[model samples]
Target: MIYYETLSINDAGTTNNYITIRGAIDIGHNGKVIIDGQNTRSNCIVIEQGCGSLVRDWIYVKNLYLRRAAAEAFYIHCNVNNVVIDSLDIRENGLEGIKIIGNDDYYLTENGICAENIEIKNCTIISKSNNLYHEDNCVYVQMAAGLNIHHNYIHQRNKQIGVPPGQHEHVDPLQTHVIRDVKIWNNVFIIDSSVLGHGMILGIQSRPGRRDTVIIYNNYIYAGGHLNPGGNPYINGFVLRWYGYVNSVYPPTYVINNTVVTSNGGENTILQEYAGKFYNNIICQLGTNGQNPANYGGTPLETFASSWNMDKTYVDSVRSNLMWRQWTNDMSFGGNRWVGSGGSPTGIINGGWNVWTNSNWGGTGINADPLFVNNVRERYGYVIASNSPARNAGEDLQAFIESKGLPWADIEGKPRNNTPDIGAFEYENQIPVEFTSFSATYYSDKVTLEWMTATEINNHGFKIQRKLGDSEWKEIGFVEGRGTITEQTEYSYIDDIISIQTSVLAYRLMQIDLDGSFEYSDVVEVEILPAKFDLSQNYPNPFNPSTTIRFSLPKETRLKINIYNMLGELIETIAEGTYEAGYHKVTFDALSLPSGVYIYRFESDSFVQVKKMILLR
Candidate 1:
């Protein structure tokens, strides 16, 4: 309770105990409640083995910055059911950021006393280890069931400060033991393959003859590999090893709709026993162009091969998994084949979305570009394009998932259509604008909402709605929309949000139909954050004297934006003034300037940026 603003502990009658800890900073205030361990404490917060292990349940911790812990930032010993850790910013921790200790001996939770539910969400954990030790992760569980981890950002940093250069060991976003009934979804893990063991190693210890499923879906894994060329540090992506004997009682594990970009020329997924259904995943070997030089009609790009692996004993049901230009791998359980035109069984099957390995099992899947929105192997850029071949190419798993009573949703929390896409994100292929994507960016003084459309029907325009904090929504502005179109279109709106100051701002688009009907887009929330000085390149670089130059200021700082010639000669001072801390843009008109390459520099107190602009006079 030391770093908490308010602590609420309510007795839940008989089973009574609900503990809540939150940041002390005022909601919407300009600061965070950071707990600096200074490498002194074993853990910032600990629910040790005996203190409340018998009665501790329903504990909620949120919105706190925790750093520099001697060991773990948050440690839960023994077992604590209904535990939730949310919105925690953890960095520079000596060990794991969030560590939970449980045991799975003979399938019993440490003395047969099992915890019911534990959840971690919306937490950003980076650099859990300062490279001092080789082992680190955002979250670690010795053994835990009924665990739900979602909507979190984990950046596994391999930099050890103040420590001598040596080999970092086993850097993973998560490391678990005897995982069962675990659901991990909607999370982004930035994995840097800067260590010896560069992937997750789950020791599935003793096989309990029972049916328990670990569901993994809608996750994005971006690897920081292939940087160090001389060494083979980019070793593996996911390695799941089961130590005990194989048992069929362990029902089906569900890994669905995940987008994973592995370190180039590395194994993507290696499961000791993939006794599950692997469906609708885009697991790409970075820079792989799927041309096996030794095989027929192969064009080698990079020396990349091997994608996914599994055991033949515990065969899996894999379908609609997109392999991006990856040459080949064992991809076990069945034989692998290419997508080409030839014989009946060798050619296209199931809409060319799968290469059925066996008669009963109908999917090893297809290989294509997926046509991602970002089109590059970058973070959070895995969303499929409007016209991506992946759209609606996945096999229907509604019957299977519905039987298991699972919640089917995309990476962005959107419900999937009947014909789903073959990746983490489902295309926003609904009516109105057929909005593929809608996002909001926060500037110091304003917020900008942008959306795209695959196609639109009966769309009159969009009515922008704004909400401050938890207040009621109000129509802020309206932008004209393309009534009806089949082509892709993008639209943007800027909200002058600074005029009325509030800590949080939410915005959404209401697509007004020409027939007077309307539909609402998903709400996007933005918070006021400290600003930094930034300069953007001018639009229409090769322009006839007119282009917009945008820049940002953290404070009311004076700026001098001047034009210079190629020979370091001054041309024109297009803008010079003290501007507020917000999004501002200036129009540069070179009406009289000659056609040549010109340098434009934004000079301020400690910030200076120069870029070239071609002016055709």
Candidate 2:
């Protein structure tokens, strides 16, 4: 459970504890593990609990860099269970830069010592806090359970100027209290309006009968206010806050597809108190010097309870009827695409029932002008051009997660195609191959198709197609198009015999575009296994009602593929039962049999193969 090949931990003024891992220690450091806490360290790596009483279970800390930490630089205490902090860089931490503790009086029926399945991924935290009392967060979790903070890049600088506001308290870069199945997705928080407060805070406290199931998706916050070139006093806060415990029973918190941008001394970018479900977000408010006069459009605070009574009709009949008529705040905004400078498209400021805008509530909310490929002035990019109306407009939160779903991609992991192009980047429209990468690989019997393109327009190349199972797609090769480029381009193709044809093969790339327009790319499947057990030969085969039958499988059984005629009877079963080992194809319509000379049989236990075709019609 150790792999340290030595990657420097200078320990300049180390008071001690530059590494105190216990509880099933599995420390790793492939390269750069630098832990220069030259600023007088408090903790530069501690996993806690061991020595006479061990408890940690499978802790795997990855790629680290832990910088000037006079305080916390990665600490996980209280028993721990399956912790995985990945790709970390964690900077100037005179305070918090990752702290996860549990059991501050545990609940969920208290058995004590919490922390379960925690995963902090792709980290880049940069916290420059000189401290003023304490609590300078960049990441701090309290009692946990399956907490997953995703793709992080959190930054919290710019807090100079006599720093003694409240003894300098600049919390939240990500702070969670009584956690439970929490998932903060695709992060990129850069809040620094002198940090008056909130860029991300969940369940501030309260754990009533304990019910927490948050799923914030595709985030990209930027709450940096105060662009004074000699203007005046400034202070703007709140970019995301979800304080809990109001009688407790909270479960419907799912602010989806976010893009939030604020700078005009910020006000509210999202502040919820309960029943939540805002959709396809884009919330912008950049005024001051942050660029384009934006402010007054700030209003996102949901706090329901108008009174349908009966606990708001059973929380409005199990969420979705979305209550709040008794006193107010039963939120449920739709599609969403607001622009800034307070022109008011009703981007959300408690106007209530939203569709686009709130003309007293009748939404479909459209303020137009979402054409950003870059929003200038200090440099920001939300990408959404090519006629940008937020592209496909979006509206499919994976059918409102009843179970585990949503967040397949977007926030730069791309992959969200299926009409999802609202906020957080997912606009790869007008494709003349901007590809970046597409693949398919299987050797020996040959099957290789590679693709790469960082940019290309009006291009006119690529046309490799192949399909076998449900058949009917045949073009096999063609590659040649650099038509218009901007560097980076690579392509390859090879499909020789595919292990004597079929085990599973599906590829696509049409592309073309010099003016002849064409599209279709996003299909790549390959599974080949053949060195025995075979049956191939049935293409156009002198006839054609429909044909295509290739086979191969060296494992996984239960087979039957029949098609006799020419007097052998049993005219069609083409395929049946379990099959999966490799190379298989099936498609035999003959329209309904007749003009024939067909006899195809491929059974399996050990193996048996037969073939003959003519189907001329």
Candidate 3:
């Protein structure tokens, strides 16, 4: 049986008090329920006790207008299990709009109650009035065994409420909590934190014990704060305090792939409680409000992100995370489109394992302007058109794919192809850019690089260049021509011969067309002096913890390099690959190991080079 409730619909003579829904209340034939509160009253329909019959149950509530209530306007208690809520708009309520307390009232009186399998997604929970506790929150849950909370937009206006002017003020803000096997994924938490008070804090006296496994992944936390004179924000990251006298032993939680940005003040320590693994999270706190900063400490690993763009004053004490590079004044992650562009400190830093060439949702992570559809509203859900870099760059939630109960792998309702575009949406017929074919040869005077295009329209020619020294790129030349309309078009360029004294001369194509169109060709080099391939001394030689090593390949060869301790038992394999003829660099971090002289060697093709480096404490 399907159950639909609208607080507005009622006969004039009939007085409806509490709408008790029994049996299975599946939504429409499409398995969705729509609940609009505009025409209704009292906010929500209460579920009386003894409703769980192990039947198929799903709750779809939307367009909710909570009018008056002291606590949660929409409360679902009793023996309810397996409930899913979506498109829920419970705004402008007197109190918390939605509360899913998973426990049997009868069982609470007798033996005990068990909270099981509940999911609340794509909902907007907010307040209507200026009263602090009156218009406090949208949703609140407790004693939940397993829950999935994702893609909900939570907003709070720091309006003063309650009695008196300043006394009894809500200094610390409240947040959505998960008790047990809970997963908070891809949700937005906007808390107006200031220098005067604390921001979002989780956990209560009846905390989810130390044995519960909670997973908070891919969520965005936007706290209102600013950068201090020294770069730290004057706010706490997240506070988890236990209230009950006897604390429950909780298991380690997993917090990964999250982006936390502070607006007004500096951010303090992350998570006051323990038991969690925080990985691949992007944390940035700028602006100052004269607050002492804090650092993250645990067995957690900071892979692919260093303290990029953070002030050194705060980073000096907590630069232990594996960063793509050292701490810089800004978060200008190189190779991304937002490298040098000003405003909205969104950029990437090239260092650590977090950098990637392809957008495969892999890093070489850039702080690019995600060109959101409704940026101001932060409905980052929609990516605009074809050129958006965020196209198909969304990471596939492995669990989402597995639990879909569908045969097709394209869950999120996407196309199933070899390499899906990274991110959320996938494009079917994006314009294709191809290099086709190319050839290069070196003569006694100069090296000539040429290539042919089989098909082209708004063809952009190629960009030709050569690299010799540190990060300095010299644009040697550019080729201008129309790619073949129907027939093939040929183009060529010659770098007039210079003394072939150097070990190598690199040549690559920079294709450009008439309409300022272009693309870079792969960097292919020609070696004049085939020196025995050796590993040069690591740069930033007197390094404190990490450094880069530059090596060359005379020919196509297989390479292997391993780091060793004083005893020489192969500490780790730094590099092992089939490298082409060119100078390439790789980094080695000595963060985890002891500080001492470490020996490393390289062997490729038929050449070998051994070197030693000192890692200072």
Candidate 4:
């Protein structure tokens, strides 16, 4: 809860109850700090004690600058829990922008605690300058578990900056960590493997345990602007350094839904583990034109293969699929795509992105160009656009074979929209720019309204509209749109005036495109419960489309409800307005909605709920 607001205040100082920070400090003891460096020097704050044991307790450092430190600019060694550091401009440090390092031993000493539940996000961690002392990575995490790393732009350019070439010469590249059961998603890593460095520039590693697992999905990792050495330009595609054997009887590792692009680097293997299940992945080598004697190829499958125990049962499980008649121990393949060619019966049968055993491996399913939206921009932003074929193309093979429904898929095993494409891309109906996802939030004054779009191709913006009972809808606010943007966009509008009249209000977003095209998200209901909102199940089960919707009014509210068809269509309006108090309901039979499956939403002063019903023919 204390702030150290001096550029020179060191962690090796006389402060134990205060958090020593540099630049504008806006952090709270209630558990959040917003450090404003005014976008000046990189060294916003340095935290490394002369002694290893003298680390702080319960601190969250964020939104600052730091440099000339032995480790990351925002460094921590204490065994703190429920801590998060985010939204900063960090660069050019002795180490990474943020470094959270601790071991089981460090935790046990601090009240028998362990480093658990930590998150780092929305920060720019870059290695723009290559100092021999600045050991790799924009961020580094060690021995920490229960972590969520997302929404950060990390780039490692060692050659651009002058760094000598040696074994331990260049920085480790990008964010490097060793942890278990971690989720790394929605981040971008543009690694320039010029100075013969490691390719795992940004990743979370699991120290092999019987139950160890790392779920890496929706990430873009590509190598460019680097020198590709013959042996190992990018080096090991992904390094899962197993220190000891996993003796527990748990399942193998899980690698899914990632798009990895490489150049002259070494071989690219999704599952480089002693044991693991590799599925629903896309690994490509955006090969360079230059041919070196060491030039393996534009995409020389895997130049250097990491050693894995062939005797392990992992290989046996892969071959058991029946499709691989003679699948071998080393499942290494050369340059190829996942989808097979359009051959006859025995060609590309199995529904998975197919890699090849050699450059000549053929199949009718392989796409010369999987058709990515922006290859260059995507090279840095690791997430595929919503329109990308890789979005939901992933086959729920594991889920199906296990006789289980894929909860994470779009719905009902429908591949994104219709038939799925190969690789990670899933080309759903182009998510229009004017299109938005229904959203409702409770605020101090009034319930807030909002929506999100994956991409806005020609979005002119949005208009906030409200309706009461069966009354006609009217525009309340005009939101400026992006006109034309390629990235996912978010917009919000609030109704403070409605709060004084009633506890609930009905609202919707009227998305308007620049060209005058438009679309609407299903109406979402916002209920203002207590601090925590309880979403209630819809009422009048099996009733026609005109069922009465009801919910408890925890507080004063603005509410809204929009009905949609099985085809994701908006058909009816149950209600939208500021309710006085208590429980209430609105009716709307499918006098207008078609006879099929439809979803109706209820948004209160603070909460939102969605329910589905069948309009039995």
Candidate 5:
């Protein structure tokens, strides 16, 4: 590991400027790797490998603050592979924050090598200027495969100084060319055209040999350039510009589960060419407020039409229009909510196009308000309220992906329930009881269930239910609630009649309110053992002074049991000698010890096991 602290390099006069690295290396910083150009020209850092080097892979660059680069901040060139740039703060760069260029010779060769497996994650890039000599961007990648750009906050903050309004055009924050197998997800982009002098542009340039598998999902983008005086509005959010190559097959682009808000300017919020599928997206235009005018942007009713046999004339007209980017009938849009304010009820103007009222294949199209928790000017909170129509309005994307045998999850890391919410956020209404922890343990052929709640309101009690294998759930017993309370409470129940026929059992707590309303807690599963050595969790864990420890033995054997503190110091010998062939229990008294976690060990001639127990006084 090479660490740097406030290191400044000045290479304005040298042609091979900046710090160049080769081979597999890990470069990090304790404070910051400050590379100040002092307004002079130079690249910050460069990583390159020779054409046929055998020892080049896995270069990690992290925890650095790069600023004021005359050219690009970090330049990754030539045949370097497996590059990871993470946790970087790159700001006020001249040309680009990071530029990745593949060797031209490699692309021309029959089986030449290209840069592969590049990942840029958890970074903040703020570019205020577009280089006068070069087309500037925050991050530019050309000729790469398996690129993942996720969880980064990128914004272009206003035009460069001395450039007049409209003269300073903004570049894309993230632009790529000829890259394949790409996934851009879970990023927040807040772009102001006044400050950045350009709208949010997510441009992808596809070429031959590209896998055509690109996914842009779960992003929150606010693109508006109305703040720039005498400047055209930069309202576009995402655009896919194909290189127009006639391949026998084209890879499909998937645009799904994104929340995009465009307030002013620009032609369209989302525009795609060639083959694409748009699903479960929330596209909002601030000007129209959920109403679209009749025939807006010459949008005929057939534009919203969907069927196996599309209108040939309408498709031909769309293909002929250059403004539509040669869009043919090869695109499919569904499960999307287009909300704007204007026009009639069935249609709305969205980025120079008409939003159809008809649902997509997933039956998802709404023009009503999402009823966000706090959605105000410049402070857009996309969280849906309890009463918002977006709740339970989402198509089951998990099911859809499962049908295709693909793995997927929601933006918030929550597994998609049977019915998902419409927008990026899944609304989770608060339950009457707030459970902190729940667990189940088996001992002596009985299952002991325990749970703790941090708070409760108007609670009647809980119905204990159990299920065996694929059988029906049966109500086992009930535990009385404390009615209404804010303090943490603990409860436990035991089911002695666990069916001996089943090897697995599942338990859940159904909390009932005073009004008879109820909600079920997540199920906990337990496995029934078959005459093997096993140790069960201590009952009433975090006990004041004493607790019971249970264990089972398949055959008679001499055993020794001892308790030890967290520091591995023997505290007590609860049971030094055991004379049992079946289930046995021992009482551990910790009246003299302080509150902390302790470990218990049971050892015999052929078997040994250790378990942890908490003691709280």
Candidate 6:
């Protein structure tokens, strides 16, 4: 029951793990099970499954508000093939918010291999670790076959309050080891001051013949830049190093369309020893590095990211990146060439970076202020302005990532224009209304549309549209939107269908601004269940002279009601009519019948149903 009540899963995935349930959760491997704390605190919640006994279920954990755990918030070591952990608020966990590890029995055949299609998504985790020299992580997965870590906001508040003076902790938002297929996207990694917090630490050794695919994209990493001009050590970004367990040729890691910015430009903002696929990224480094931390302003530190070995591949070709800062460099058309600031390349044209690396690699990169909607100097202000240089200045990523039907939308689920924008956000410059959610549901032969807006500016109202099957959309009704408000406002509209012609209906909303500027929301669809053809028991069964019986029909048909006696003889013909596909009622008057048990038979098309009633007068 909690499994079906927890998740609203509709699609039948390729894995066929989604099973529709209306009963208690007994089919373990078929549906989702939620261990919701109802927003209560917990010491910890452990979902551990040994290799000797694997459930291989579709496990999902969500809606939990866990904080201040003794160790980690959730110690999940499930052998389930796919595990989705989302929408949990984990705070001040001792070490990690979620920790996934396996035992030494990796190749156990008790159930099957522990190959995980794990997804740690849509969760907010914060750790205020006061460890002096210990390392901490928001998510640490050791042995997942394919991991999708996306849409999470992780903040490591390494405040260093309880620690001794002149000592700091180490923190990482995401750290994965030995993950074969790893995808980290659409996450905000906020690192607190006084600690060396890296955005992602992806460690995986090279496979002999098969490639270990790793993709990192569409993330906004705020490496610490408290701007104290006194404290806050350097904040690190992408540490893509594999441990030397099986050293071979490095697999191509695709780092594309990410916005990596630092408040305090510390050491190794983006560091990778080997060559990888880098394309259409925006690296903004504020202030300078260690020793001399003078240039705290938004000046271009061309030496911020260090990727010594860079190349152009299917995922990295046609690189057109943007760097938001003032830089002095010579422009030359070269692919993935890293050079120093205020200089030209002294090496080969196609040779990767020369150790120190560069900022002017000449792949459609403009070294100027990437005017964000808010001030770029702000720690995490990332969305570019309408007049920003980052707008429509990068590569077309929709075709690149969606050719294989991958999830390739911006951070806000906006579609990419032909010429996409740089950074994590695709610049649409949508003013007025920012909708949080909009949905439609069918009830009582009517479609009720509901929506909520996070913030509204110069908003007018919403024009509701409806359609059936492949028909054109028609304006159904309108709900007035909040004029201009910062608080979240919810709106709903009920469309009473006069006729139920189709079993499915689609609805959309056109949110018009006060100044005639308008934007359309995503279309929502609902399937209307057919009305059952049945007769309800008569109300006031033991009546003085009259009783009422209601019947529902699935389709238009002729119906008749007859009164019968206990001997099965017809006493009276009460009603007869051709009724439509809806509910109908009829009154049976037993004024002339004797005070005894009477039977009523309802005959429609070829079916007859009988019900006994008492007439006492």
Candidate maximizing lDDT: 1
Stretches of candidate 3 off by over 4 Å are 1-42, 48-71, 102-111, 129-135, 161-178, 193-201, 204-210, 225-237, 240-247, 288-377, 381-617
Model 4 TM-score, all chains together: 0.51
The 10 consecutive residues of candidate 6 with the worst lDDT sum are 3-12
How far off is residue 486 in model 5, in Å?
A: 24
lDDT of 4 by residue, 1-617 (tens): 22333243233322244353333445443343433333343434543332345544434555554434444466555344445666666655555666666553321111223355667776677765543533566666665666777666676655433443445443443444445556665556666645444445333343334354555544555554554443344434444444332333332345454555555434353324344444455554444442331455333445213244322322212211111101121223322212222321222212222533222234212223233445432332332344443444445554432232122332112244333333433334444554446677867657777677666644557778876556788788888876435556777787775333234557877776443556766776665443334435555566664566556565567888888876777786677888655555566676654567778887664677888877654
Q: Across residues 284-397, which tens digit of lDDT does each residue of candidate 5 receive? A: 544322222121221211122222222111121121011111122121232123222231232222333222222211122555555544442232344556676666665666
Q: What TM-score does each of the candidates earn?
A: 0.59, 0.31, 0.42, 0.51, 0.52, 0.57
lDDT over C-alpha atoms for residue 70 of model 3: 43
Per-prediction tally of clashes: 5, 21, 67, 70, 15, 9
lDDT of 6 at 417: 74
User: Compared with the true structure, what per-residue lDDT tens digits does model 1 show for residues 37-70?
Assistant: 7788777777654424255677878888888888
| Model 2 alpha-carbon drift over 4 Å, by segment | 1-33, 38-68, 71-92, 96-125, 128-154, 157-168, 171-189, 192-195, 198-221, 224-381, 385-439, 443-466, 469-504, 509-529, 534-617
Question: Which candidate, 3 or 6, has the higher TM-score?
Answer: 6
Model 1 regions lying over 4 Å from their true place: 1-16, 24-30, 51-54, 104-116, 128-133, 159-168, 197-207, 243-251, 288-316, 326-362, 375-378, 399-406, 429-617
Q: Is candidate 5 or candidate 6 better by lDDT?
A: 6
Give the Å shift of residue 513 in candidate 3.
23
For candidate 3, lDDT tens digit of each residue in 43-84?
554533344553223444443334444445577664455565
Clashes of 4: 70
lDDT tens digits, residue span 20-108, model 2: 22223235423464666666767678776432155555655677678776778887776576667887788987878888886665343
Top model number, TM-score: 1
Q: Give the 10-residue window scoring lowest on summed lDDT in candidate 2.
A: 307-316
Q: Rate the local accuracy (lDDT) of all candidates.
A: 0.64, 0.61, 0.48, 0.49, 0.60, 0.64
Better of 2 and 5 by lDDT: 2
Off by over 4 Å in 6: 1-43, 51-57, 78-80, 103-115, 129-133, 161-167, 227-232, 288-292, 295-303, 307-318, 326-364, 375-380, 434-617
